[model samples]
Target chain A: MNEREVIETLKMIQEEKLDIRTITMGISLRDCADESAKKSCGRIRDKIRRVAGRLAAVGDEIEESYGVPIINRRIAVTPISLVAESSRTDDYLPFALALEDAARDADVNFIGGFSALVHKGMTGGDRKLIDSIPRALAGTDRVCASVNVATTRAGINMDAVSLMGKTIREIAEATKDRGSVGCARLVVFANAPEDNPFMAGAFHGVGEAEAVINVGISGPGVIKSALEKIRGSDLETVAETIKRTSFKITRVGQLVAREAARRLGVPFGIVDVSLAPTPAVGDSVAFILEEMGLESCGAPGSTAALMLLNDAVKKGGLMASSFVGGLSGAFIPVSEDLGMIEAASRGSLSIEKLEAMTAVCSVGLDMIAIPGDTTADTIAAIIADEAAIGVANNKTTAVRVIPVVGRKAGDVVEFGGLLGRAPVIPVSRFASSDFIGRGGRIPAPLQSYRN
Target chain B: MKAIITVVGKDKVGIIAAVSAELAGCGVNILDISQTIMQDNFTMMMSVDLSGSSVSLKELKARLNGIGERMGLVINMYNEELFNSMHRV
Candidate 1:
């Protein structure tokens, strides 16, 4: 290799926050079902340990060999609602605990599967799992839960959406001492991806192999730095610059994903080339927007800027890997991004502006904090709005807002480390209880006519 | 297998002699060396082949890291594929 190339790669790693965000092992637990909840829990733990025993060790070895950091090693199993159906139990708390125990034993950062997909309707097990989410997230340290309440083909399940609002309030109160941090470990999604390698939404789908390795690569700082070189570029030039940097970043992801899968003796899954930002300085998707001449993130023309970025990242990543999937676009989670946190703390960024941006960006209403007294109907209304956007546009959208207990607007609650702090974004005080009270389904939009 | 070694720190003498002598001791072959000084700081890049090295690649990295510590520099050895995959394609 030439000296210039080596120096550039090193600078990207040391200065620009270029790294693989996660290496997730997807394992299907469909066969671990039993009539007894206790027996099912036992089988779940043993299956996870046996399948992912060398996962973390292999991750460490690859990190050393490549001189690039792989920040998290996690596991995703089939949704527990399916596996626990055969068990004659009303509570799925034991299933969540089993997954947490297996995560600790396998040396993974988090385990996700305590999830239910009730996009159209809810089965008995699905309803039980949804009821269990509040206690499941509060009780386990390393377990994450997600509920998919809307899909483009099946339409929005208003019943599940309304229930999730109450579930989120319960989670916040259950873990209120920690600034409602439990809510950060849960997500409500519309059209959630089954093979997502990232956090609270990842799950091993029914059609996946027995085991696979999926990698998530993040480099918001890298793309921001690239944009700095051309100070007065046009919009076309800005898109071109972002596309080139994303290509280089995603190639490394494909490499790490390939090597990790090879050493672990599992088939390699897709690489999620997302511009996921962190709380660290110089590591934010908002900075990339600001670098493109926006006064600040969420300012006027913010939606246009985010649209360019999201499309360019996907185009570049699609060219770099033969198999690219997951949410391969820019993520604008407020608390997790430094520039976004700054903008929100000032009154420049609001929940309303964020909702508009989500119509074009990757995710929706992520990591925002709301006042404690906000009604469940209001939260459900927000989810319904976000779901309508995803279903109409035929894309993925999600909500993970934390209603900090005993906190109000302009009050900042600290979540420390990765899940940073957020100022409570004020909600409209006007009630929507009447609308949410009439629970039914929002029929599929006309866009679902692809037959 | 091949690896790239990079040294970055304040400029000083004997940096080359100390590094090459250690590489020779491990029976490693040096293919190319590039050294440059800018703004009173030292940066050196080396391309090395470890197929015939007596010690493992991990051992050689540890030895180089030890030398870098004594000399107050930041030294790193990375697999060449990291560069090839990102820059070549």
Candidate 2:
């Protein structure tokens, strides 16, 4: 701890906006299953409440003692579909309600895992859970829902993809009074990670320990500021600079994750080395891309720039932590990033370009607001396209588009707080109903044949 | 445990005196101190040993922040582990 290092760290915190984005305790609920939904929900709630009781207080203590801001304290439970499968009742709304109750009791921000994994095909419980998503998300405030519709190994489940498209539309319609904010809490995934700490995509997988603590690091501002100092440098130098910055940022996350896990007496899960952005000025992933010499985000060469940035971040972060999992790359959620929002509003960025960018970055078209008239088929097509990228590349990608009800293109949807606001970006008018209607498994690609 | 205390604000009289007095009152030993003035703003950084201090680290931080507020300065206290973990491998 030399003087220069101390000053540099302080600067990163004060000026560069480095902070731990979340400390998510992943609690497995497999043992809580029961034949009766009532008893099952009761056991689920008790398990979450007991496991994550000290999460928020511990997060606060760490933040205060270390002088690093921990933005969120959340919990991720095992996919409810698996846990509630033994229950006879078809409705899974009670499961979502129980999750919300436990989240409230534990005093966490969001609780994930109201989810079903039907990448290959759907089970009876998975179908019921998928059917109840719209109602579940609409009714519960803290519960987030996700469905893994594609995987590199299992291929894409077109039936489930189509179902999710319709589910999202139903969710939007059910919560239209709140500007369809419920849809924001639902994520459709391809190759979803088991230990992700970010939401609405995080869920505890079956293979994980009974309980674990995972951390997500955020510092788009720090990386952007670091690149700002190396302006006019070559592409290689730019990548190197980003790598160094990510290394420093991820080390802090590793520290916090270890300390939190120790205090909570939970096994430490992987550190998600993602540069998650906020709507605040200077705290944006798009700004990092633009600082790399793009005229604006979504411009030509934006994907190339993002690819370099993402690869470098992972390269640097891998050395900082021994166990790095989750979506360890850059996130380009439009509404959560001021630069992307400005670009979208001005037409400098479009949904098409965003789709292309997702081919290279971590997540797919995220936090984007589409026109109210956008059809379920089109959203499903969008998800399919992003899934193709993830499946082909063997990486994780997710879609969390909110189609603001009654708002057409050129309108703005205000979802204030960390969710931020989004300008309604127009979707393709050309229909994809015929393609989505032809629902069957898009068989695993050639790349998936390596085994 | 070691902690670094940094103070930054417009240059003024008795800034060091008041800060050191507060630390000494809490039985915190200052191992190293550095001060600089750039463009009429004063900046000070100190390496202090808190293991011998009677007050908890949180209390010392709060006390130092209070002193900083009264002196129209900004003070930050961070555990040295934060720097070591970030900078050293």
Candidate 3:
């Protein structure tokens, strides 16, 4: 590489905070199914241990060799609802425990796929998994649960949606001592992607290969810094800058994903070009939007700016990698993003604005903390609204809100580490219980007839 | 295989000599070298061929990190592919 190129690349890492957010190994647990939940858990643990034995160590080795940080080494297995379906257990807590133990043994921070897809309808296993979410999440530390309540193809499952609302409340109450952290581990999705490498949403779909390596690339800081250099540029120029920066960032992800897959003898999946932000000052996606001339993240032109940002990221990333999947857009998780946290704390950002942003960006109301008194129906309503947006737009969207039990609005709860801290944002005081009480599918939109 | 070794720290004597000695000790051949001093801060970049190195990249990195610690410098060694993949296409 040329001297200027080398210097720029080094600057992107050393100063701009460009890094691989996650390298998720998707392991199919279909073969682990057993009639006994005990036997099933054992098989699950052994399979993960055997497949992901070198995951953390290899991640460390890659970080050292490449001089780029791989922030999370995670695993996504086949949805537990599917894997544990044959097991004759009413409670799936053992399955979650097995995932947690295997993740601990493999040295991965989180294991996803404690999930059920009920967009169409719920099976007995799906019902049991959904019911077990509160206890399962409360019982385990590293296991994440996700439920798909709506899809463009299958429409919205209001019954599952209503159930999830109550489930989220139970999860919050069960983990009340820990600031309702269990809710943070639970994601409610609409049109959720199978190959997503991001947390609270990742799952190995039945359509996927037995094993694959997926990477999530992050660098809102780099894009923001790039835009900072071209201050006062036109909109087209701004879009071009973001696209070029995203291309470069995703190239690193592709390289790491390929290397990890080769070393682990797994097929390389896709590189998710998601501009996932951390709580660090410079890594916020909201800062990138603000840098695009917004007064704040929730300003009038915020959605327009985010649309430009998200589209450009995808356009650039599509060219850099052979395949691109997952929620490959800018994530606006409130607490995990310093800029969003500040905006929310200052009252410039609201849940309504965040919901609007999700229509254009990646994910839904994420990492947000709400008042403890917020009812289950209200949380479910929030999920339904976010799901409607995803279904109508035919994109991936998810909610990972934490209702800090016993905390009121404006109170701050610290989750520490990568989960970060969040200020309890106010929710609508008006009741949504009557609407949520009517349980049936929100019929598929006309757009679903495209095929 | 090739890698880039970057050193950044306060300017001091024998920084290059120390870094080069460590690389040579591991049988890593230096392909190119660039050095500059900016505002009393020493910054050096080297392109080294590690195909003939006796140690693995991880071991070489650990050794270089140890040397950097002892010399009070911020030393980083990265595979050349990181730059190529990012900057090329």
Candidate 4:
């Protein structure tokens, strides 16, 4: 063992906040489906508890033994819509509640997959699951929900997009007392990944194995700390530093992922090396972009900075881990990042700039708060625009904006914890109801037609 | 079967003697040891073979943590594979 490298690794953990963000166990709930809703919910709960009973314990073991904090233990199940659709029910809230109960039993903080993949169209169950999202999220504390209204292969479903806008509004209204925090747990996505270990968007795709363990490695602080050492260096050196740092970070993720999978007797899945930021000042991806000579994260050169970062992160992480998937780039959740919060609050970071950054960064329009009076059509339009970007680029995009009820622009809303605090930023005043009212599918872009 | 133990804190007499005594009592054989004073603080690194030890890794950590808290030092024992995985690979 090299003492110098040991000291460096320990220093990275002790001061630089290098840590495994999440260890997510993806369990297929396909076998839990039944014609009866009650039976289906019961089976779902039982299977989750049985398969994931040791998940949190194993995560704790890995954390303690490796000296890396595994911050979250999560479970992403097969989308409830696929299972609940076979059940004779219009309401899928019971399925969400079952997930909530199972996660609590297993001592997991968050359980994702109260979701529907309706990029092409919505079936009866998909519509039911989407309809029940507001109620499920408002009622459960740990259950997360996602709706994929667009994909590179399927294009955008304007009807689903329109419905999601209304659904988000309903969630805002239902959880109004909690600063509309329920909306924070709901993510609307374009080209959503099947094995994402991150919350509000993770789900086990149908083609995935019966059970798998996917890990998300987060180290914005680690990368920033590395960049600080090479100050005054050129962009080429900065990119190289990021790539090298990312490789080391992803190796930690691979170690934890393989250990967790071994202990849980589940097949190992991908390691999502997303520079997932939190509310902590030291752990901000925005600060990394700022560290690369930008005045602030959302400055004029920010998109280029983020593009270099995203590409380098993917390149570095691809070789370190056996499997690399999910939104494997830098995440810019405005509310969840301290530097981004500072920039957005100072008016340097705008929604328009974020949309551009999304084209280069990992996901799109994430955790942004807009005006309360923003219409559903306008929200739908925003989703449509973001979806267009994802489909055209053949990448994933998502919108998890909270239109805080009765709050206008320039107000702050605290959702607390990892969801963080968001500032209510302004959007365009121009209306797009006509375009949204024409509720039909936006055809798949030329880029998506690749065979 | 192998582990790396890192101890960092203020320099003190009998630090090595106390740590080695604990390892000897637990039947853990120290393969190599390195000690240095970086700046003003004392730092020690140990590569140990734990295959013959009677204690589990979790229990060994608890014991070391007790010693650390009393000595005003930070002590950590991790599976050696962790170092090889991150720093080597």
Per-model CA lDDT versus the true structure = 0.92, 0.93, 0.92, 0.91
- Model 1: iRMSD? 1.3
| Greater-TM-score candidate between 1 and 3 | 1
Docking quality level of the chain pair in candidate 1: medium
Query: Estimated TM-score per prediction?
Result: 0.97, 0.97, 0.96, 0.97
The C-alpha RMSD of each candidate to the native structure, in angstroms, is 1.8, 1.7, 2.1, 1.7
Q: In candidate 4 chain A, what residue range of length 10 has the lowest lDDT sum?
A: A442-451
RMSD of 2: 1.7
Higher-scoring candidate on lDDT, 2 or 4: 2
Cα lDDT tens digits for candidate 1, B28-47: 89999999997888989998
- When candidate 4 is compared with the true two-chain complex, its DockQ is 0.70
How good is model 3 by TM-score?
Answer: 0.96
> Candidate 4, clashing residue pairs?
none
Could you give the candidate ranking by DockQ, starting with the highest?
2, 1, 3, 4
Residue-level lDDT of model 2, residues A1-451, one tens digit each, is 5567778999999888899999999999999999999999999988888888899999999998899999999999999999999999999999999999999999987999999999999999999999999999899899999999999998999999999899999999999999999999999999999999998998999999999999999999999888889899899999999999999999999999999999999999999999999999889998889999988998999999999999999999999997899898999999999999998988989998998999888989899999988899999999999999899888888999998899999999999888999999999899999999999999888964665
Candidate 1 chain A lDDT trough over 10 residues, lowest sum: A442-451
Interface quality of candidate 3 as DockQ: 0.72
Candidate 3 lDDT tens digits, A69-116: 999999999999999999988999999999999999999999999999
Best by lDDT: 2
**Model 1, residue A390: C-alpha shift (Å):** 0.8
